[model samples]
Target: MYRIGELAQRHGVNNDTLRFYEKHGLLQPSARQENGYRAYSDADDRRLAFILRAKSVGFSLSEIAELLSIEVDKANRVCSDVKELVDDKLVKVSQKIIELERFRQSLQILSDGCCGGPHSAEHCTILQALESFEENDPR
Candidate 1:
């Protein structure tokens, strides 16, 4: 068994992270000492490692919770259970990349339109383009 600080140190995470994990049901201490300190077992270490791994792969807390739920089910295989979630996340990430690239193109257009120096605000092409887009955007 290990104290909360010890466990956090061993895992290279903050004490608050351990507490937050406990509060959010991502992790649980195995027991409490007489002095009211939390004591963690090796199982807690493994769980924390799993949480970290999931986080590194871009899983949100809610998604991690779902994954943990799947992990506890004896009949569910990990690969099949996790594949759909990962696929969905990948789609979302791809969409974000496309949106970001579009945004970059728009910014480039604005940058190319603007010839910066001694220009009045009313004569700024960038400002004019922004106002035009704002008024014309249906979405």
Candidate 2:
């Protein structure tokens, strides 16, 4: 049996991380020692590894909980169930990438409009653009 610290150290996570996982029902100790320390079995170690791996791939705690539930009852789950979750995440990620691209384009426009001159800002294109408002701006 491994102590909590040992397990956390092996996993490169803080002690509180382990406790948080336990509290969130994502993981648990196999037993508690006589001295009141948590003892983790190999199965617990494997479970922790799974949790970390899921997190590395952008799964939120709640999503990871869903995955863990499915994992615990794999016999009743089809592969499409897991694929659908990934597909949803992919859509969200793709939307974020598009938003970021638009932001980059806007910044580029503002940057290209400016000469970056050392002169005063009285006639700076960037500043003027910032202060100018167009119709139908909605605010």
Candidate 3:
């Protein structure tokens, strides 16, 4: 038997994370020691490691719970569902990457326009460009 702190350290997780996992039903119910402290077995450590690894790969708590539920059964439906979720996440990640690239390009344009020479804020080229946009806005 291991104490809660020991188990958490061994699994590279915090005590609050363990408590949260238990509350979310991702972890099996913990056993209590005679003094009312939580005790864990080696199996619990393994389970927590699985949860942490899944989370590191972008699985949400709810998704991890579902995965755990079907882990023992090896259900085809569950496998397909997880695949779909991963596909959707991939799409969102791709879109975010594109958006970031666009933002970087825009920032580079602004940086190139700005003069590094000492100048008042009112005369700054970057500020001038922003003022030009404000003037052209219909709103």
Candidate 4:
């Protein structure tokens, strides 16, 4: 068994992260020592690894919880259910990428329209375009 600090250090996460995971119901101690310190078993270590791996792949806390439930109840859940969750996340990520690219293109247009000289902001094309967009935007 390992103490909370030892587990956190071994996983390269802050003590607060371990506490937060506990609060979020993503992690639990296997037992407590007489001094009131949390003790982790090998199973806890494996669970932590699963949580970290899911987070590294962009899963939110809630999503990770769902995944964990599915994993623990494997007799009732199938691989297709996991694939569906990943597919939804992929669609959201792709849409965000498209929005970011559009934003980049707009910024590039503003930059290209500017003289980029050492002048005052009284007649800056970038600022003017931004103001125009703000004024004309329906949203």
Candidate 5:
């Protein structure tokens, strides 16, 4: 058996993460020591590892909980669900990539237009461009 701190240290997770998992029902109830401190078993360590691995792969807590609740015999069903979640995340990731590329292009344009020589704000093209942007932007 391990105390909460020991379990956290063994798993390389913070105590708050373990407590959050318990609060979210991702972890089973912990046994209590005679002094009322929580005691964890090897099974708890396995469960925490599973949760961390799932999170590393981009599974949300709720999604991981659903996946964990699935019976071992329903492997195909679990696979389908996980696949759908991954596909959705992929779409969002692709959109973000596009947005970041656009932002990079805009920044490049600003940098390219700026004069490298030292200049006052009143004569700076970069500042002028920023002022124009502020005037044109609605928010």
Candidate 6:
């Protein structure tokens, strides 16, 4: 049996973070002591470790909860559900990479257009491009 502080310390997490996980229904203690202190078991330690691992792999708290729900179901023995979630995240990550590439290209174009001459700011090509881009853009 371990108190909340001891459990958090053993796991290298803050006490409030453990409390937050409890509040989110991701971690629960085995029982409460008479003094209202939380009493955790080895099982709680294992569960918290799982939660941290899931977060490290880019799983949100809600996503971890969903995975946990499926994990608890002894009747359904399938891996497709977890695979689908991971596949969806991959698609989203791919789309974000594409968007970031486009943004980088746009910045490169702007940087290339600048001469950095000792001229007035009003004559800056980058500024002119930005000012006229919105009006000329069809998208």
Clashes per model (N, Cα, C within 3 A): 0, 0, 0, 0, 0, 0
True-vs-predicted CA distance for residue 9, candidate 1, Å: 2.4
* Candidate with best lDDT: 4
What's each prediction's TM-score?
0.82, 0.81, 0.72, 0.92, 0.75, 0.75
What C-alpha lDDT values do all the predictions have? Answer: 0.90, 0.93, 0.82, 0.94, 0.83, 0.88
Question: Top model by TM-score, which number?
Answer: 4
Candidate 2: tens digits of C-alpha lDDT, residues 51-99: 9999998989998999998999999999999999889988998999999
Better of 4 and 5 by lDDT: 4
Estimate candidate 6's alpha-carbon lDDT, on a 0 to 1 scale.
0.88
- RMSD to native for every prediction? 2.3, 2.6, 3.2, 1.3, 2.9, 3.0
Candidate 1 deviant stretches above 4 angstroms: 74-78, 116-122
lDDT of 4 at 60: 94
Where is model 6 more than 4 Å wrong at Cα? 111-139
What lDDT does model 4 reach?
Answer: 0.94
Give the higher-lDDT candidate: 2 or 3.
2
Candidate 1 lDDT over residue span 3-111, tens digit each: 9999999989999999999899989899999999999999888888989999998889999988888887837566866899899889988998999999999999999
Instruction: Give one digit per residue, the lDDT tens place, for model 3 in 1-139.
Output: 7888898888777889888998898886358988988888787877888899989987889878877767756754656766777787778878989999998998898899888788678788888888898999999
In the range 35-60, model 4's lDDT, one tens digit per residue, is 99999999998999999999998999
TM-score of 1: 0.82
Q: Which run of 10 residues does model 5 get worst, by summed lDDT?
A: 70-79
User: Superposing every Cα of model 6 onto the true structure, what RMSD results?
Assistant: 3.0
What C-alpha root-mean-square deviation, in Å, does candidate 4 show against the real structure? 1.3
Preferred candidate (TM-score higher): 1 or 6: 1
CA lDDT for candidate 1 = 0.90
